[model samples]
Target: MARFYCDACKEEFEHSSPSKKEYTDSFFGCCWQYVAPCPQCGKECTEKKEPQKKKRTSSSGGGCSSGCCGSCSCCG
Candidate 1:
């Protein structure tokens, strides 16, 4: 997790730095987008990367945080 200051809105926000895979995927996708909430502006901004196919689309462009298992998980 990392924090960034948005000069446009003059706000500070805590953002999770995209992983290598996320960066790569976003870079390859049409728009490498990262979601981060601006503290001062209270606005959500998309951090664009190189742009690749959007990664983690199964549950709406995010990873499994509910502890649910996917096909890849044999335990599931």
Candidate 2:
């Protein structure tokens, strides 16, 4: 989990990067979305983070996307 400081809500909470390939539409495109609620204000906020592609060759015969399982470490 990644901690994000929202100036609007004045609170910090865990954040997860959205999966862009999971969505299909003319609006979403290639942009990823982050969904989370503010701890202090209890307001839902959607933050956008561009999808990052990292190339890796694994012996297991599989590919992994950018970031760690679509999650980040909470640095609070």
RMSD of 2: 15.7
Residues forming the 10-long window of minimal summed lDDT in candidate 2: 67-76
lDDT per prediction? 0.53, 0.53
**TM-score against truth, every candidate:** 0.30, 0.33
Q: Which stretches of candidate 2 lie over 4 Å from their true place?
A: 15-30, 46-76
Q: Candidate 2, TM-score vs. the true structure?
A: 0.33
Candidate 2 residue pairs in clash (backbone atoms < 3 Å)? none
For candidate 2, the per-residue lDDT at 13 reads: 61
- Per-residue CA lDDT of model 1 for 1-76, tens digit only, reads 6555566786555677632323345456543445666756756655443447755534432335554444335434
What C-alpha RMSD separates each model from the true structure?
14.3, 15.7
Can you give the lDDT of residue 10 in candidate 2? 67
